[model samples]
Target: MIELSREKLLLLYRQMLSIRLFEDRVYQLFLLGMVPSTLHQYQGQEAVAVGVCAVLNRDDFITSTHRPHGHAIAKGVPMKRIAAELFGKVTGCCRAKGGSMHIGDYSVGMLPAIAIVGSGIPIANGVALAFKLRKTKQVVVSFFGDGATNNGSFHEALNMGAIYNLPVIYVCENNFYGASTHISKVMKLENIADRASAYGIPGVVVDGMDVLEVYRVASEAVNRAREGEGPTLIECKTYRYSGHSRSDPANYRPKEEVEFWKSRDPIFQFKKKLLELDVLSEKEDNRIRSEVEKEIEEAINFAIESPLPSPEIALEDVYA
Candidate 1:
């Protein structure tokens, strides 16, 4: 509706569908104890990552959190590699070293996803700093949670980003809770993006459930950063239907709250919007979903059959 091309819209919808299906598959696999590590599923916030990545160039970057399957796929990391990494295979993106929390493919410009909350902020700032020093138009997109906004790293990163006019987009995916603690109880600010004023930068709030809305807002921020207009704080108001971790009982929240957000599922909403726009027929939608399902199954098979990392290799990257 905002002059977006049909091709771009279909691509956006595909990315959103990929994330939704991938995350759902990951959740099911994790519940069966097939995965060795903990998972912070990005089930509900697919729109934020997909939308932000849509407007990015191949040379641009993104930082991810523990809930990073969506970010990885959006950034163009192959599912086979992500699945292999989760299985600790040598063919993984990180050679099975990074696992679920740290899956990233830097060759395409996705820096190693920082799993520690708010830790990627400074690293992304440094990447932007390098680009700015070189006078290139590259921009780094940093993704963090609401709890991260309360971290010292978040404050420090924003301060430095402001002072240096770094080419970076700070995307705060506020999925309400910071590992079970609601944003309402933690910060006094009504909108996390409003905190951008403390550093004298533009701040914005967008509906994270709506992919196009996120893309529109993020396009502005990415362009501004590339043009040396400095960084902007974009707080994506989203909700994660899953628990904080696959292990958590999610006792901190109410069932009604979970259901409320679930009803507004990003994947369903995106498909509906696409249908309304006449961009896809019901048969075409089902086919797309079926394709994703087949790919996921193949990835699972590949991961299961892949060779595990050598025991000697465990000591290989530890020091060097």
Candidate 2:
């Protein structure tokens, strides 16, 4: 693994911690009916987004899945904007039109998340095509779940990307389930990355729970794409600590299974690693946590104070 500077390491820790705290706070607000619409919390898979986005430039793009809060934060979207979006405030990244599942900021190179499974795969390819046609060295990373790998869009998009050598990275955040269905129930293959061979592209599997490992693999893939080597299918073996949705109890999963994944929590593991490397101390870690908490609180206050969209202007941005 490539050595990371102390600054970068701390930034990664802060980003992951921010996502964890933000998601936890959102869940609390959701229970209190403060957040509107449905929610898909990104509680356990912070490493994948933070790790991958760390290797990207500000001009590079990323297409997020329904559970996109982590992606938005990792891509430099302000927490206040995301919180505002979740609260349906006018200051939201999408001006309140897109809520939790649709959070993104174009200025930060994140497309408003596509709620449809696997839909963003093709859209990312289209964006990558634009970059290629324009002869820009930009790349687009597409984030999806294991379930999306089964969708026809996934296959078609990968094939097209391979054929044209599009600068796109297909990251499969395999959390072991599609909603409530486990991956083993649908596919016999041991690893999702193995499917890359069918499209003549490189495929790699990484420990999604380990930020450093994810970063190492992502760096290679991003470099390959930037150098005109084409796309790669990276399968991140991760898990979600929360239920599929706001209303899901997630009881379908066995108790031991949940406990096992929780034991390897990405944020916890990363913090421990940093401490071991002497890159962080107990006091410093506490400071970071305290700062993150304050930031989350500020974001919540900003979203709460922000005004809702005017009803008269409802159709202002509607093109249809």
Q: Which of the numbered candidates is closest to the native, going by highest lDDT?
A: 2
Candidate 1 clash pair list: none
Off by over 4 Å in 1: none
Q: Write the per-residue lDDT of candidate 2 for residues 94-211, one digit (tens) a residue.
A: 9998898898899999999999999999999999999999989999999999999999999999999999999999999999999999999999999999999999999999999999
Instruction: Compose the digit string of candidate 1's lDDT tens values, residues 162-219.
Output: 9999999999999999887888898888899989999999999999989989999999
Report how far off residue 4 is in candidate 2 (Å).
0.8
Lowest-lDDT window of 10 residues in candidate 2?
311-320
User: Candidate 1 — what's its lDDT?
Assistant: 0.90
| C-alpha root-mean-square deviation, each candidate | 1.1, 0.9
TM-score of 1: 0.97
**For each candidate, what is the lDDT?**
0.90, 0.95
TM-score, every prediction: 0.97, 0.99
Prediction-by-prediction clash tally: 0, 0
Top candidate by TM-score: 2
